[model samples]
Target: MPSKLSEEISPFYVMEVLERAKEIEASGGSVIHFEVGMPDFSTPAVICEAAVRAIREGDTRYTHSLGILELREAISEDYENTYGVKVSPGNVIVTMGSSPALFLSMLALLDPGDEIIITDPHYACYPQLIKIAGGVPRTVRVYEEEGYQIDAGRLRKAITKRTKAVLINSPGNPTGTLLGPDVIRDVASLGVPVISDEIYHGLVYGGEAKTILEFTENAIAVNGFSKLYSMPGWRLGYLIVPEEFVRPLQKLQQNLFISPNPFVQRAGVAAIKHGKREALGMVGEFDRRRRAMLEGLRELGFVLGTEPLGAFYVFVNASGISPDSHALAFDILENAHVAVTPGIDFGQGGEGYLRFSYAASVSDIEEGMSRLGKYLDERKNKSR
Candidate 1:
């Protein structure tokens, strides 16, 4: 057997849901998508123009293993301005989205037997990434009762001497909860290095999202242009590593990725410098959809946590309808023609919930919610 057959990593189940939705659509069924976390908008005109100019001006070649100096500088300056954290351009490593930066962070930080503590109800990819980087993923259960924030005491209990770091995602996927700055500070006081995924930072609906840099210097901040800038296909993101991790991460970048695409990096520069208005506009749209979905789901008797302050998702409790979220999700897809993510995709503690992304247009979200409402109503009648 091939070595690929011997490994047992779990698949990203929400993506499978998306694939099934696509199959249904190809067969002439209308599938309203709330499963995938992609924005339903085009890249900003400024970013597109910059990429075109870069390519025409012969900026297509690989510039540096760490990325073009100008793009890195822009990212550094953006961080400084946004969070009051001064990061040298040398500490920024531009990668092909936050995914590669995550891989590199794990590789640079963890050894084979090391453990990484992450919250339950985390982004689906976190544990898989830890496993691939040769580390054990230790999960601390976070409840919807607490707005899905990790309990500091429980998290501290999960940390062992072998633990290398704590992984946290604010404006987190599936749950859509933003970690409080005080929680971040408490976690950092443990003296463990923290890896904060702040990809959804600029998409908040209420209070501002805190960058880990504002709370701790012993953190790696992972951010990308995809979510906030509506530049998913651009595959451009950067990491802000502590001064000490800079050289090691750069070496990893040199060997693993060489660099993110040069033209895309130029587009990233345009995004940071001139695309704020366009990006913020998308957040406003998502905010409207978020309110719509929350109201609709509540009418369907789906209990929710406190409204999310950031991110474009609503994580709802479906235990009343079905404790098995996977089955409930499929029921919605098959009967309601609306696709959603089962909480199991996130982690163990997520088993009784469902995640609905409001990154689509208002019409699609409203239609999907209507379908869901009808389906759940019929299910209740049937049970009665």
Candidate 2:
């Protein structure tokens, strides 16, 4: 029999929405996708060229389980440059992506029945990953009015003897709200290990996102090239662990993933060292799309409780129209041909919300919002 863990993992609903969108497109219908967080931009040209050069130079082979020394050094330098933290190259472990970096952190941190505190309406994979690692997830509800930022006090109250760590995402998914520095400082003082997901670090618009390393050494920082460098398909990410955790994480990486692709590691080095100009350009474009999305959603009567100045998403209250976000999301896809993610996919706190990703082109975003306006209007008239 399959283990209960395998049976109990919830479906990632956004992937379902994406699949249905594909079906629609295969049938010759148009789909304006707001369902996935994937960037519409291509990987930076310099990064791509570096990868190609590595491939041609026959650099494709297994690397150090912890990653190539060059990539690790590059990652270490970045922490110093960006966050003013001196991260040693010896503490870095590269992985296939940030997903594996997070999973490995869970495995290394948790014994069976150990607990991790997370925010409600968090990234969809958080609870599932904890469960897979044989840990329990305790959620603290974060409100839309508070910009979906986790309250450190509530998080403190949630901790018990079994509490192993606290997982946080800045410029978070589904909401795109950056946690303030005060919140980060307070959370760091809570006397627990922090698993900080900094995947969207360079994607912030208003103010900078702070790395947990700046406040505490008790952190496993998970980051990758996917969001900022537009290299999702490249499958490259790394973790910054304390010196003590390095060997154990290295062992886990050796047994599980062996090492990330050698050439991809080279590409990651190039991205960190040389691709910032291209990345900044993409961020500028995303900011423009963000403004357009906010205006369009407001015009359509959706309630945005807080400004989403980071990442590429706007999580809005859709309960005034329909309480079931899952059903409503599908209805929009089927009727309006605009694909979006349901809030319930994040957690129960998200049930009556809808997350719109502005990763699509501004033109597509405008058209999708217009289609939604028409769909809602036509539904109201028919009911009358």
Candidate 3:
């Protein structure tokens, strides 16, 4: 039995860091985690109640391949209400998660050997997903000085005849930098399809994230209930595709997944329609933790690329302490009992950096910072 070439993809390194942290915890040692991107909070009461009601009502059967009509309509209305963008229910494809949404989109749009351009320091899974869909991922390096935004000129330069789409993540993972509308418009002007991952849209701290729909009609908007609604385990997400691509994407979804879980789709409807206030409340909590982590890292002499404006992560330059961020992350886990993600997991431009997620509580972040401070102090003393 042989595995497919795509099955030989590289590991998602953040998971490796998490496994190491778990091992340390199993040995009866405490580890303050800043590595994982998941929220420490539980699902909102409204979402949970909805799920329970659906289960009690015996709504566990399979649904339409695209999703339950109600959930898809709610998702479409969400775009209209929140972003003032008109999306028809017919254009929405409910997915198992944004992961499968990405897979479906790439599969529906790209042919083998087709190329997709993405920023260098991107969410680690983007390239792997492209490979599995039989497409090639072309990365354009983004500099930290520009706050890790993809330069429009560099993106245009990277576009070759085989380029099928440009993938972008706003309130980007690891860096947490949000791209402005100008950049969004520039990329859309290239006439290539754009795939915007807006899973972190509502969780932004400084300002709202821009929807690619605001810039171009030729883009796919992927969003989920996980980050914004604190419902990761629900495994419910949606993608708003261009009208032209909707039916083909639906055909692919029907064969690949049949439909999202029926009860989960009902829960998703409640999440989008009635869970707004509860979801907004979580954003406030994440904002506070974001500030605390930023201040703590600065106090410890780490140079960050920018103050994170949206997502709950702070990407810091770790080259001053060590060039090998992966080794440093492991060292910190062992010595200080704190776990952080190595930037190398993101891409080449992120090699000398480390991503700290603020999804944990303030107290946990404070304790992690204290451990980091003590470790740095001891290192300085030894140097003398």
Candidate 4:
């Protein structure tokens, strides 16, 4: 029999959407992709040049399990400059990606059957990571009407003696909603460790997304270079753990992944020092696409729970069109040739919604929206 662990995990529905979109394109169809969460932009030339230079200079070797000191120090300095928190380099653990940082955090802290709390309609992987770490995921249901913000009172009630951590993602995945300082404090007050995923930090449009370190020293902050630098394929991310977790996480890092790529780490250093300007420019473009997509989606009669203040996604209401977002997603893909993620993939609370990513170019966003609108309009006409 296949391992039970393998059986327990569900597919990342976004990938399925992408694959089906590709199949259509291969069969002589035009597809406008809005399914995946990655930015359509190339990795900044400066960052890529740095990685290439490192490769050409033969800088390929394993870095320290805790990562190169230069990169760690850069991350430490960023916490001070960006979030006003003074983090020591000794506490920073570089991992292959923020996903690993989160997994390591859960593995390092959780005992078998320990529970981690998160908000529903969350990033698809949050609960899976918790379970993979041998912990139970205790989810608090947050609604689209409230911008999918966590209800701290519910979080408080959900906590049992077995709860080990409270995981939060802002400028969040799928929903694109940000949690404010007040909500962070309420979560921290529960006296459980918090894992803050700040991967989409620099992607905010109007307001800012805060690191957990800003509210308390008792949390783990995970941030990375992917979304900011448009460098998802580079696979470089870091974790800022409390002083107490420094060594244990480092040890876990030593075992699971000896170190992330050296060339990538070098590129990461460049991303921090010289790539911010490039990233900011990309963010400007993303903001433009975001606005265009939001306007287009609303015009098509989808209800947005709140304006997305950060990230490049708009999770809109689809219950008016169909209750099964999963089936509806495929129908849109096959008929309209515009791929989008089903809300059911995000969790139960997300079942009646559809998450559209504006990480594509502005033109692509406009075209995808047009196709989707046409498809819906045709469906209405047929029903009438």
Model number with the top lDDT? 2
* Global local distance difference test of model 2: 0.93
lDDT of 4 by residue, 233-260 (tens): 8888999998889889988988888888
Model 1 lDDT tens row, 203-258: 88887788888878889999999999998888888889888888899888888777
- In model 4, where do residues sit more than 4 Å from their true spots? none
Query: lDDT score, residue 368, model 2?
Result: 96
TM-score list, all predictions: 0.97, 0.99, 0.98, 0.98
C-alpha lDDT of all candidate models, in order: 0.88, 0.93, 0.89, 0.89
> Model 1, 137: alpha-carbon shift in Å?
0.3
- Minimal lDDT window, size 10, model 2: 144-153
Q: If candidate 3 were superposed on the true structure by all CA atoms, what would the RMSD be? A: 1.2
Residue 78, model 1: lDDT of: 94
Q: Model 1: how far is 140 from its true place, Å?
A: 0.9
- Candidate 3 residues 87-177, lDDT tens each? 8999999999998998899998899999999898889999899998999999999888888778888899999999999999998987898
